[model samples]
Target chain A: AQSVTQLDSHVSVSEGTPVLLRCNYSSSYSPSLFWYVQHPNKGLQLLLKYTSAATLVKGINGFEAEFKKSETSFHLTKPSAHMSDAAEYFCVVSDRFSGYSTLTFGKGTMLLVSP
Target chain B: EPEVTQTPSHQVTQMGQEVILRCVPISNHLYFYWYRQILGQKVEFLVSFYNNEISEKSEIFDDQFSVERPDGSNFTLKIRSTKLEDSAMYFCASSGDYEQYFGPGTRLTVT
Candidate 1:
């Protein structure tokens, strides 16, 4: 079984400041990690993915995440937080070796940006 | 630049009524999936389809839920009888490879 846990429920940051959202996962097989963002009343948009190729992955809107196998973590980061960046972020995990391709999502971390 | 698209941005239905949420996934994609998120909850996978049939599904997708790709372009999710608890935002996603492209989602309000 695979599962994900978001470390923060809500994170508040000032505009132009750095931001971080942490996640951890547990899986029985090789795992694929992903980050998705959702605006108010909207569907999720894929931000980035880690499929064993690279530990550090960059995504759209100036967001990025690093997958650390030793730490069992995949934390999202951005150098500068924008007002438009305020949204709900989810950390998801799935196993490539498992027949069940469904994703297990973290509870989510709501980013709050202040100008 | 292609993305998944869903219809009826919002739908209001009575309890026990059937609801059909439609989607047109990115052309050339082989795998399709349906997911749902209740207010203030995590996104939950409902089903996954490939090769013109269901490849996998979550426990949440019970007898009341079914998916189909009846035509060449459109994919759909039909809830045989929606309950008030079924109200949520339903998203359709498709993947040609591993990265799934998601739709804007359809908000279903079961009253």
Candidate 2:
């Protein structure tokens, strides 16, 4: 079984300030993690993924996430938040070892970037 | 840059009516999937298709929900009889490997 928990339901950050969205996972097998952002009425856009290749993964729009094995966490971060960064973010997990592509998604965190 | 495309950005239907959501995934991708997000809720996976058949499905993908690749380029999700609860945003996605690219989604409102 695989599941993901996004710790924050909502996060507020000022423009040009740092941003953090926390996520934790539980999986019986080796897991692949991903971060996706969804603008209002838009489709999900992949931010980055951790397929066990590197612990620190960088994605588009100045977004990045670090995977921690010991803590079972993959937290998304951005050096400086922009007004355009306001959106809903989801943390997803898939069991790569199981050979299936089905993904389990978290409830999501709504990021509010204010100027 | 290749991206998934979905038709009928929004649809309004009566209860018990049938609706078909259309999608054209990335040209070279083999895996296709359907997911839904109810208002103020999490995105839920409906089904995954590969090799012309269903690879996996979630509990929400009941008998009324079906998926098909009628042609080489088009993937579709059909609801035989939509209920009020079926009103949500339906997203179509496709992937060549592990990273799935999603479409804008179809908003189905069952009244």
Off by over 4 Å in 2: A97-100
lDDT of 2 by residue, B26-86 (tens): 9988899999999888889999999999998999999999999998899999999999999
Model 1 CA lDDT for position B76: 98
Worst ten in a row by lDDT for model 1 chain A? A95-104
* Candidate closest to the true structure, highest DockQ: 2
Model 1: per-residue lDDT, tens digit, B1-111?
898899999999999999999999989988899999898888899999998899989999999999999997899999999999999999999887667878999999999
Worst 10 residues of 2 chain A by lDDT: A95-104
lDDT of 1 at B69: 98
Candidate 2, residue B53: the lDDT equals 99
**Model 1, runs deviating above 4 Å:** A97-100
Model 2 steric clash total: 0
